[model samples]
Target: MAQNPAGASAAGKPRTLAGRCGSANWVCVAQCIDVTCVDKCLAEGCEQALDALAQCAEKSGCGPDDSACVSRVCGKQCGRTFEPAPPSPEKETTDPCADASVGAGKVPEEVVGRWTLEAASIRPEERPRLAGQEEGVDVKPRPDFESALVVTSGGCFLLRTKLEDATLGRGNTLEIRSWGAFQVDEKKDTVQVWTKSGQAVGPVCGKPRVIGLSKGKFQRPVYTYDVEGDTLTLTAQTPSRQTFQFRRQTQEQKEQAE
Candidate 1:
């Protein structure tokens, strides 16, 4: 398992994105209940959205009404009568993996440290064809022989895969997961990397998609990392053509404690 980012600078704790619940975000009715006495969401500019949801749910007999409300909230000051704004509403969203039945396991304590992406090996891919060529089109994930990103925890990573060119950019999802269960040996100066998913998977042209995998209990015994010169280097097997190096996160590099 890998560690989740913590401290002040860690990215916002991964949470469920709104539209991820279903194929859409504008839910006509709560999957379970509708509390608003009046039809059509009466959220006057998102300010009263949460309150309305809570009140409506309570009125409609939804148990723990407060927990049922979910809306995209803003952090702006909208005081018309010179009063503090109401707290934001909460919603019940399933983790993306939960739908696919994926769980965030406890990353090992040693793996809890940070690792810089010294190398990102993605294969060359074709741009989205306009038309006509759609049939024989061979679109694949662009190879990233080099790039930047940091690994938190030692398990699987779900990341935003964007390839940039000045202001213009191309994008897709990229998966880079460790091969097997992460085992730590602070005394041996070695970090064993194995494959649970057998091999790294895809560059599927979609955002928020799982790419590289280690599905079960880390299968492939792929790379081996050696802590050298304040950095970690990972080597892949033949035909894999990928090498990754990382540096243990230092105290200063740690996000300021929140």
Candidate 2:
């Protein structure tokens, strides 16, 4: 994060943007100022706007360090009186995975960390075609993307992917995120992931959509896995065979890479 420029108040004392917005709201405020007119509003002492942005960030479940979510969701309303449209009253549905358990399996010590996707291989016949491509074309090219996987010792995991679209700007890139519980069987060299929830968010030719995973139901996918030094390989067992290679990432490296 870049340091905010120091500004002077009428009392002739130097004040920073972080100081202007209380520490609790600083993260969202900083992100708002970066992509909107929140900085100017702050200089003019717009407390209401700042408070609204902070509230929006919290209600939307954005993490403290999630600048992208802040900018995307709260930026437009930063300098104005934010009036969120009331959500239509609908029946609340319970999430099946809210209390789903991984059940009776331990996460391997070597797999309990962050990993970055390094390479992937798929048979030519099973390769996925690019959007809008003609049929029967063997020109299956790998999509430009970055992905990260986080496996926890507590049997939980998160996978995040950002698919790059050359025609879209950085602010509107496509992102897929999923979180679930995983069970590893050392004896069988297999890992099973039960996806609790997943979502896709971004623009497709200027049309934005947020689609749920598999109609909001749970999915269990199993893979044969191998770990050698820092490298981890996962090969699909059924359907079409595909393999993915990942490299373990240190805390510092993960921070810098992000």
Candidate 3:
């Protein structure tokens, strides 16, 4: 997990942003600012805007709704407001693998193996194609993504994914490695990974879209798996309900490739 610059500066305690507004600078003095907002501002080097917000907060005497107050004040100086992001609609814990239908036996046992990604694709409906990308043309995900997953007998899993998208920006790539304990319902043919707080590792693209994924378990998407001989397929639904697919790699294939 990446430590916040503000928090890291104070020997683990959050340090206030620079400002001189006395008590009204409550937002700056906050033990922790909204990470998403702060990160965005820092990325853009918006110190002046931050200082303006601090000054506004100090003068305005923000009420109980600190977020709203910050938004209202910061908007004036920054030309944009800072509202808490809307909660993911996918927060409902609906298990898609609830039905005990296809798998021959326990899902955990069936999924205990390594899988290599062959291809990946993102639906256009979920994210609009970048400029100059022809509509209706199938863009192969292999060039943009390299990923693999390993599931262990002891109900643990490790996944690594690296993606490159030139359209995002010059030389920007997203890399993520996540590990956590997993839960499987044998009867339901379902699996969900309960990630620990700081499991995500490695550098990721600086694009705002990928930045959120740096934490890795945002909303903790659910997944269901199917195995057919040497072929294993796992399907996952994103927070926006977009499905992603992954295929398994045999031990022989993995070793030979290595």
Candidate 4:
């Protein structure tokens, strides 16, 4: 019967009790991520999971401000783990550059530059077969497709891609561009992208149109990258893991700025 921040039920019942959930209930919600709570609910066959979650907050008796209860009693009893609390400032070193260098990979310095995608391929085993193709065929981007990844000095990255496919029709290609902040882990040889914003340019109803990306916040498991000579290869985990091979853009390409 009450309204919550996420809105209300069609029948005027509370859709979410988040506002009324005590600190304990909120703690359980955080831990339910990646857990088999839904499966557990199905097994129980009666919304026992929901009842358990609601009971967490109801029994805690902690006030809205008492977040400590989440860890000290509620979360622990609920068998959920919160990401470890961040180290206190006093416990952390005062070096400002420490944060910058911490995850920088073994050769983070090598990642800073303009790189152009030469090829992209997906593992055959993980992807569906193309029409008239064999069951295990690794798919590669068409020759006309163009992609570039530029990493600047201060952890900023820009990605641009263009593709020409028969499916889209003759003389028409789709262009996609996105920019975001990124962090590199040198030890892990990985990169993570965040805060992505971008747009797509393509034909719509026989005319060119530009449309913005609907995603505001984006992130994924760290992508692995390898560099050799002027070549860079980035492997990302998608529905099927994909590998994108790139080459450092030459002065000529930079000047042309396609």
Best candidate (score: TM-score): 2
Q: List the candidates' TM-scores in order.
A: 0.29, 0.49, 0.42, 0.49
Estimate, for each residue in 70-180, the C-alpha lDDT of model 2 and write its tens digit: 556765543232111222133222232344363224688998888877765533343353445554332222354566677777777766655453212222344555667
Task: Judging by lDDT against the true structure, name the best candidate.
Answer: 2
Model 1's lDDT to the true fold?
Answer: 0.28
Tell me the tens digit of each residue's lDDT in model 3 across 1-258.
111223233322222233211111112112111122223223333334445455665576666345455445444442321211222222221121232331223335667777765533334442363456664433244454455666676665555544342211222233334454566766766676554312212211211221122222222335565677656544554432223344567668679534
Ranking by TM-score: 2, 4, 3, 1
The RMSD of every model to the true structure, in order and in angstroms, is: 18.1, 18.1, 16.4, 19.8
Poorest 10 consecutive residues by lDDT, candidate 1: 23-32
Q: By TM-score, is 1 or 4 better?
A: 4
Runs of candidate 2 exceeding 4 Å displacement:
1-105, 124-143, 165-171, 201-214, 256-258
Better of 1 and 3 by lDDT: 3
Worst 10 residues of 3 by lDDT: 20-29
lDDT for residue 215 in candidate 4, whole number 0-100: 29
Candidate 4: the clashing residue pairs are: 103-185, 104-186, 105-185, 105-186, 106-186
Model 3 lDDT, full chain set: 0.39
Tens-digit lDDT track of model 4 for 40-105 = 212222234334533564577766445455334454332321111222122212122224432223
Candidate 1 residue-wise lDDT, 1-258, digit = tens: 121011101222222232121101011111101111001211212224334333433354433322222111111111221111232122222122222223234444544545544433321121132344543332222343212223335343322122221101122122222222344445554444332332222222121323222222222233445556667565444343334445565666546310
Question: By TM-score, how accurate is candidate 3?
Answer: 0.42
Error of 3 at 4 (Å): 23
Ranking by lDDT: 2, 4, 3, 1
